[model samples]
Target: MSISPGPSNLYILARTMSDGHRSGVAAAGGMAIGSLIYVLLTALGLAAIFRYSPTAYTVLKLCGAAYLIFLGIQTIRASGAGNTSKPKVRIMGMSKVFKQSIVVELTNPKTALFFLAFLPQFVDPQLGQVALQLVILGLLYAILAFSSDLLVVLLSHNLGKWLSSHPLFIRWQDRVAGAILIGLGSYIAWQEFIQK
Candidate 1:
C-alpha cells in the first residue's frame, strides 16, 4: 500500500515535476506526518468516528474532492498564463507545499479507514497493550511509506529535469497535471455519491 499509485503518489510526482526535489521531499515528509496523525487517531479510537458517522465521512470526502478540484483549476489557469517567450517555472515555498500535502492526506477518509481495517489484523490480544502495538505498527508503516515516497521523488525529479528541456512538454505538463487532479477529484466524488 505504501508504494501503490494513488493520489498521494501522483501529487508527489506532479510537485516534483513542477517545482523540484526539495518540494517533493517536503511533501513526502508531510505525508508521513499525516500518516502518523492518522495512526495516533486510530490508536485513540477516534478513527471510528468515520466508521460510525456517515455524515462526517461524507463531509470529509466532499471537502477533499472540492480541494482537489480547486487545485486542478488553479493549475490549469497557471498553464494558460505560461504562454510566453520562455517556459516559466513556478517557485513554490516548500513549507506551503508540505502543508498542502498534509491537508490532502488528512482529507482523504479512506486512509483512516484503511488503517482502521488493516492494522488490527496483526495485533495480538495475548501480547497486551494493544494501543502500543498499534502505534508501533503505524510508525513502521509510516517509515516504509516515507521511504517509498522518497524513491518516487528522486525518480520523478530526474524525469522532470529531462522533460524540462523539451518546450512541448513544458507547455503541456501543467495541463496534464491539472487534468489528473480534476479526474481524481471527480472519481472520488463519483465513488462517494454513486457507489454509496
Candidate 2:
C-alpha cells in the first residue's frame, strides 16, 4: 500500500480540483471498484496464473511500470496548463477523475497479487465458502483503504487551498505528482529487472 502511488496521486488530483470532497469520493469509489475487480478475479483463482507463470508476472509488472511512467509524463505536461479559476475549476470532471483513478488502480498488477496472497491467509476453507470469504475480506480492506485515502484527500485539499495563493505552488502540484510517479515506476521496473 505504501509503495503504490494510487493514494498519493489521488490526493494530488483531489487537491487540484474545485470540489475536493466530491473528487476525493469519486476517486475512492473508483479505486474500490478497481480493487473489487481484482478481488473477484483473485477469488476465482486468476492470480494463480501469476504465481505459476513468472514470465507473465514480469510482463505485467513491466506493463504496469510503463503505464505509471506514461501517467507521470501526462501529469507533468498538464500541470501549468490546468484550470485557472478561483478554487480551480478542476482539470477534469468527476467522471474523468473516476475513470483515471480506476485505470491507475487496475494497472498495478501487484494489487491483484496482493489480494491473492493476503486474502487467503484469513480464509478457512473448512469453515465456509472460500470465495465468499475472500470477497468479504477484500471488501473490508477496500473500505478501510478508502477511509484512509479520504483523510489524505481532505488534508491535501486543505493544503492546496493554503498554497493556492502562490501560483508557483499551484503550478508545481502536478509536477511533483509526476515526479513521484516516475520515480515509483522506475523503481518498480528496476526491481523487476535487477532483483532476478
Candidate 3:
C-alpha cells in the first residue's frame, strides 16, 4: 500500500516534475507527518469518529476534492501567464507545498479508514499496551511510505530535469500537472457521489 499509485504519489510526482526535488521532498515530509498524525489519532481511537459518522467523511472528501480542483485551476492559470523565454517553474514555495500536502493527506478519508482497519489486524491483546503497538506499527508504516515517496521524488525529479530542457514540455508542463490534479480530484468526487 505504501508504494501504490494514489493521490499522494501522484501529487508528489506532479510537484517534482513542476518544481524540483526540494519541493517534492517537502511534500513527502509533510505527507509522512500527516500519516503520523493519523497514526496518533488511530492509536487514540479518535480516527473512529469517521467510521461512526458518514457525514464527516463525506464532507472531508468533498472539501479535499474542491481544494484539489482549486489548485489545479491555479496551476493552469499560472501556466497561461508563463513567458516562452522563461519557464514558469517553481511558482509555489516549498513551505506552501508542504502545508498543502498535509491538508491533502488529512482530508483523505481512505487513509484514515485504511489505518483504522489495517493496524488492528496486527495488534495483539496478549502483548499488552495495545496503543503502543499501534503506534509502533504506524511508525513503521510511515517510514516505509516515506521511503517509497522519496524514491518517487528522486525519479520524477530526474525525469522532470530531462523534460525541462524541451521548449514544448516547458510550455505545457504546468497544464499537464494541473490536468492530473483535476482528474484525480474529479475521480474522487465522482466516486464519492456515486457511492452515495
Candidate 4:
C-alpha cells in the first residue's frame, strides 16, 4: 500500500529536499520500503523460503555480501577520484525504493531478528489486518530513522565538500563512509556464518 504524505513525513521530506542530503533520504527511503516488504512477506507466512532451506541464508548472505562489498568498493573508488559536485540519485519510480530498502533491511541477520523480535511487541493479532499494521509501523520507523540519517546526511554532505577541498580533511568523508560500509558488510557476513 502506498503511504500518503502527512505531517509525520514532513520532517524527513524536508531534510531530503536539502542539497546533497537527498541521496541519503532517497537511499533511506528505498531501504525502508525494502524492509517493510520483508516484514510483510514474513507476516504473510512466506518466510517459509528461509525456513525450509539451509542454502537460503547462504545465498542471502552472498547477495548481501555482494551488495555491501560493492558499496564499499564504490565508496573507496569514488574517494580516490575526488568528490563529485552532484549527489547520486538512481531514477526508478518504485524499484529504487524497493531494492534499496530491502538492502538496508537485510543489512544483517540481526536486523531480521530485530524485526521479528520487536515487531511482535506492537503487532497484536487481535488487530484487524496485522500485516497492514506492521507495514504502518515499519513506515513510521522508516520515517524516524530517515529523519535522523538525513540530518546526518545534510551535515555530512557539506562536510564532504569542505573536507575534500581542504588539505587537512582531504577525502576524510569518503574514507569514513567507505570504511563504515566495509565494516558493516564484514560484520553482516560474520553474523551469517557464526549464526549458522
Which candidate comes out best when scored by lDDT?
3
lDDT of 3 by residue, 29-128 (tens): 9889989998998889865787788787788888888888887888788787556696354688999999989987887656766687777789998989
What is each predicted model's overall lDDT from 0 to 1?
Answer: 0.83, 0.70, 0.86, 0.54
RMSD of each: 1.7, 3.0, 1.5, 7.3
Question: How far is 155's C-alpha from truth in model 3 (Å)?
Answer: 0.8
Per-candidate TM vs. native? Answer: 0.92, 0.84, 0.94, 0.64
Q: Which residue pairs of candidate 1 clash?
A: none
1-196 per-residue lDDT for model 2 (tens digits): 6224543344335433434667777877787787888788878987688778888878877877887787778767767565546455455678987787777677675575678666678899898788898888888888877776676677767776787777777666677877777877787799888979
Top TM-score model:
3
Candidate 4: worst-modelled 10 consecutive residues by lDDT: 6-15
Which tens-of-lDDT digit does each residue in 1-196 have in candidate 1? 8787777788888788888899999989988988999889888886577668878878888898888887777778878755646647665689988998898787765565668777878889899998899899999999998999999999999999999888878878888888888888888888899966
Worst window of 10 by summed lDDT in candidate 3: 81-90
What is the model-wide C-alpha lDDT for candidate 4?
A: 0.54
Q: List the candidate numbers ranked by lDDT, top first.
A: 3, 1, 2, 4
**Which regions of candidate 1 are displaced past 4 Å?**
none
Give a tens-digit lDDT track for model 4, residues 119-176.
6578788878877887777767656655665555566566555654564344344555
lDDT of 4 at 104: 49
